[model samples]
Target: MDFLTSSTHLHITAWVVALVLFLVGAFVSKSKGIHMALRLFYILTIITGGALFIEAMDYGMGMQYGIKFLLGILVIGMMEMILVRQKKNKPTTMFWILFAVFLFAVLYMGFKLPMGQNFLA
Candidate 1:
């Protein structure tokens, strides 16, 4: 669909996918099925995010795009650390805090700020 090819559509879709993953991951953190689903969702999140970044760069929105990429990496790293690390230390609280901060930042970028002038244009 033409909408899928549009930058706005891609951006929105990325956010939707990320949110869904976050929610489902939370709900099914202890289940093998949910864990597998979350993992696949994260992989898709990364791919879609990369596509969005490329689109932004192609449109000359480099700084904003770079910030987004960095944030994404930070979030993904946090996620991996939370999910893959051995349960030696109790880090759930810290991970949740980090996730909250990242979510807030994403919201600021997506809704509260002038995204076009801030990042790409």
Candidate 2:
């Protein structure tokens, strides 16, 4: 139980795995297996993230957590949007750009915000 909540362990782990999965999907564009794995990672991310958000709320950091949570979901959405566009053989330049921007923002906020990892600390 302690491990689950400690230092946002679960949430971080899920995101790391999801990142790897995302990369796999990107590299293996036509692989349904990679796509399925990426989808699973998305679910894992959401579950772990929800747990962390609830914990944050208990510590009176709900607003900060909420923003991060939404950004995280947006990141996932961007990934799916890219995949969808690719599947349809449509241009994905815009979605790719948005994904990169959102990914940077989410990572920056997660490590910089006081309510988050505050990696500098």
Highest-scoring model, lDDT: 2
Please give the CA lDDT of all the candidate structures: 0.61, 0.82
- CA error at residue 99 for candidate 2, angstroms: 0.7
**Segments of candidate 1 deviating more than 4 angstroms:** 1-5, 8-11, 14-18, 27-29, 84-89, 112-121
Error of 2 at 22 (Å): 1.3
Clash counts for the predictions, in order: 2, 0
After superposition, which runs of candidate 2 have C-alpha atoms over 4 Å from their true positions? 1-3
Q: Model 1 clash pairs?
A: 61-120, 64-119
Local distance difference test, candidate 2 = 0.82
Q: After superposition, how far is residue 15 of candidate 2 from its true place, in Å?
A: 1.2
lDDT of 1: 0.61
Q: Candidate 1, residues 28-56: lDDT per residue as tens digits?
A: 55555655665666676666666666666
